[model samples]
Target: MAERTILVAGTYDTKSEELGYIVEVIRAQGGDVVSMDVSVLGDPPGRVDVGKHAVAAAGGSSIAEAVARGDENSAMQIMARGAAAVALDLYRSGRIHGVIVLGGTMGTDLALDLCAALPVGVPKYVVSTVAFSPLLPPDRLAPDIQMILWAGGLYGLNPVCRASLSQAAGAVLGAARAVEAPVSGRPLIGMTSFGKTVLRYMVTLKPALEARGFDLAVFHATGMGGRAFDALAAQGAFAAVMDFAPQEVSNHLFGGLSAGADRMTGAGRAGVPQIVAPGCYDLVDFVGWQGVPRRLEGRPTHAHNRLLSSAMLDAGERREVARAICAKMAGVRGSVAFVLPSQGCNEWDRPGAELHDAEGLAAFCDEMRAACPANVALHEIDAHINDATFCDTVLRLFDGWLADGTLTRV
Candidate 1:
């Protein structure tokens, strides 16, 4: 394999020794290194491949202008923008195969922006004091970035921090060398669903779609999974999308486990044709360990595991969720087909099930029928979402789209 080049980025003015150590480790592993300095006030004792002046300039501001702001946050923001631009340029030019950044809170803040600038599948790692902390919001994180705790290295390099830093350096280099970056080989279809316990359409749809000459990538519709699905969809990664498990949409609206605000709108904005269904429409998942909120105290609840619990929505809330879903699909550039399984949306909500609520399901279906915009084609199926008939209905629409040239083949 060819020698990989890794970008070592951080506030080099303060952490020059530590950053230099990371570079040395990468070089020792037979990998090349490109150093970037994001310092505002001081300069690194050694020169960097990309200096603070160039980084600040790339962000549309000079270091002098950033210093004039007289605030660390403002100055760092400028560096963050410039660093992201420079790093992305390096990746696009095939100069850097992967990136590993070192920082505390301030460095981590900038690291997030820098990593986000790179495309998914490129190796991005952050060795930070705040690694895996709640200080980092889910929305700001790059879909595939990895983080390692910068343990015991808050002030300076030590044996403890060296262990973490060296491992991070090696991991990024190894990942860049081994990664099979996403390639456009077959026509890819992106689908979202829960496991077979709750939703089973993918089991039937996967083999059937493959038989028809397409590859399907199924995304678990939890928080981070939906985020990844949306990220890939926004990149126009799929020929078409099967957005069947959009419970995250309701989760976002009602303060459950959210996959960020821009959950179901990616494929639409990118003009990728999509077929959507509310696979677990009637239930909102919340952190299972927390006490149930006062507003949802009396609703029927089902504990899926130690980490996740679902609460049934009432008839009124169900209608609200239906309206929310319709609102998101109203102005899409691509074609949208909404499949509403009228009998039930999940196994927990079927006849004699723990979350069975006939009245709520009927309300949601009715609201969906009334609220669906002219741009969206609504298909209301009589079967449950987990049933074979529901999968058949989706396949029929998908086949028709492929035949009519609504979806391009690979």
Candidate 2:
């Protein structure tokens, strides 16, 4: 195989010894290394391939200007922006196959920006003191970025920190060499849902969509999964999207497990044709490990697992969710179809189920019908969301859209 080049980046002024050790290990493993220094106030003992001046200039600032700001936060923001721009350029130019950045909290913040600037398949790793901390929000994380805790290496490299750095170096190189970047062999269909227990339509729809000469990518509707789905959708990565389980919309609005405020807007913004539904829309998930919040104390709740629990939304909240969905759909630039399964949205909400609420369902349905914009095609199906009839309705609509040129065939 050809030699893979990995970009080693960090605040070299402070962590030069650590960064150098990583570079040395990569070279020892027969991988090429390119170093970048993102320091604002000081310089590395030796020069880097990309200097701090170039990084600052790429960010539309100067090293002198960054230093003049005096505040460390403001200065690091400039370095982060510049580093992201420079790293993206390296990837686009085929000069670097992977990147590994080392830092504490400030460095981790910059690492997030740099990783987010690259496309999804590229290898991006962060060796940080704050790796996996709650201080890092889910929305800021790139879908594929890896993080390893920089244990015992915050100030200087010791045996413990060296162990982490060595492993990170090897991992990024191996990932770059082994990664099979996403290929567009067939038209891709991006879908969202929870597990089969709650939303089982994806189980049937996956094989069905594949048989129709398309690839189906189902994203779990949890916080980070929806973030990944939305990120990919914003890049116009899908030929069409089946956004079947949009409960993340409610999660975002109610401070549940949110995928950020931009949830459910990705495909629409990219002008990709979409078919949407409200599967599991009546529940708001919270971190079960943290216990139920005070506000949700009286609501009907279901504990899915140790990690996740959900509470049923009241009738008023259901109406609010319906309006939110309609408001998001109003801005679609391409064709959109809204399917309202009248019987039930999820298995938990079916007749005699633990979360069955007829009044709340009725309120949601009424508001959806009343608020659905004129531009969106609303199909109020009599079947439940998990029913075969609902799947058939979706397939029929998909086929018609392909035939009518609303969606392109692979």
Candidate 3:
């Protein structure tokens, strides 16, 4: 019987021999090997489908043509684009168990894109000459994005390469055998939070959720952090969503602050019980007074730190925000509701605070009432979402939904 396939990737033209050697190592470690010939010049040392050709649609050039052009810059871009097609194919075919790649900056760029296409958990090792720097890719291209660094591009570094190859082979096999069971618990409940806004979700909402036998995963509502929360929510990982930061909505509606996901509210769809609170919808967050964009230079701004400011939201943007909220509310699978902190949303948005603005607040609330589906309970709680008393009442409502499957606000 044949063994499983391990994808070996690289600029096969430049590093064919090394790739072949690595392939040999992979096979010896009890795996069949497939090669993605991401080369620009020479032929791969082993059986390989030309990378440029496979990736042709992505880069609009044949591998041979890319090689003939002899432009490293163009070739690298072509290779990166092409790699996407090849990796996608490999993944769909289920022919790839693990992947190992080697490259310089161009090669690395191309391969990382391919790596990014893989699932969240996979054994992916990069034997690169540029691993010394701390410049890991931003998107976490591969779950296991390790590298073998050296001055000699994947070629001259034989000893280190051999060690990494052996280790990588074992690592891949071990990963397949020892797949980590997902954290055991309820569907993931996304908890949105900022340092200042954590009390509502953590102190108030989280315990309440657990009391109802729910397992919660909290997400700090930093720039991209909210998306991370939403991602988990969308995956059906969370049975419920406790969104306590409506302030992130400010960032989503207007270029205001480090808010939630770009499409922050999309996760409130079918498959989860969500209690949405616009906890921070009242203000726009910016980087300090100076970091405020020129167009926003004169807006009411509260300096929160050397690099942070909360600019008050405008009635115009708030109108759009109300629409956004209504759309999300209308799509809720279970009962979906929005809570309004009557006194304030964020710490700075309270009366006499820097973000105080009655006009903008009314516009948002009124719009919400007008646009939101009648099924969505709209509450203008007399107290803030984080106040202990407010939390108790909110949880009482949330618990009823969790237990009886009832929808609507008290």
Number of backbone collisions per candidate, in order? 0, 0, 11
- lDDT value, residue 352 of candidate 3: 78
What are the TM-scores, per candidate, against the unseen true structure? 0.97, 0.98, 0.68
Q: What is the per-residue lDDT of model 2 for residues 1-410, given as tens digits with 9 covering 90 to 100? A: 79999999999999999999999999999999999999988889998999999999999999999989999999999999999999999999999999999999999999999999998889999999999999999889988899999999988879999999999999999999999877579989999998998888888889998888999999998888888888888888999999988999998888798988899898999999999999999999999999998778888999999999999999999999999999999968899999999999989998899999999999999999999998899999999999999999999999999899988765
The 10 consecutive residues of candidate 2 with the worst lDDT sum are 401-410
The per-model lDDT (C-alpha) reads 0.92, 0.93, 0.65
Error of 2 at 1 (Å): 3.5
Which candidate ranks first by lDDT, i.e. highest? 2
Lowest lDDT block of 10, candidate 3: 136-145
Report the error of model 1 at residue 50, Å: 0.9
Query: Candidate 1's residue-wise lDDT over 1-410, tens digit each?
Result: 78999999998899999999999999999999999999999999988999999999999999999999999999999999999999999999999999999999999999999998898889999999999998999888988899999999988889999999999999999999999877567899999999899998899999998998889999988788888898898989889999999999888878888889998988988999999999897888888899676667888999999988988889999999989889889999998999999999999888898899999999999999999999999998889988889989999999899889998676
Q: Candidate 3 on 1-410: residue-level lDDT in tens?
A: 34567778877767777777777877777777778877666665556854546765566777677767778788777777777677767767877766777777777777677776665445666766666454653344443455665344345536656676566566665565455533564544667767754244476666666666666676666455665566556655566677776566666566654434334454655456677777666666766745877656677876656877776667887788778767766755666766766655666666676667878877877787788787777776777556775676667767777568553222
TM-score of 2: 0.98
lDDT for position 156 in model 2: 85
- The runs of at least 3 residues in candidate 2 whose Cα sits more than 4 Å from the true structure, single-residue gaps closed, are none
* Model 1 worst lDDT run, 10 consecutive residues: 290-299
Ranking by TM-score: 2, 1, 3
Question: Predictions ranked by lDDT, top down?
Answer: 2, 1, 3
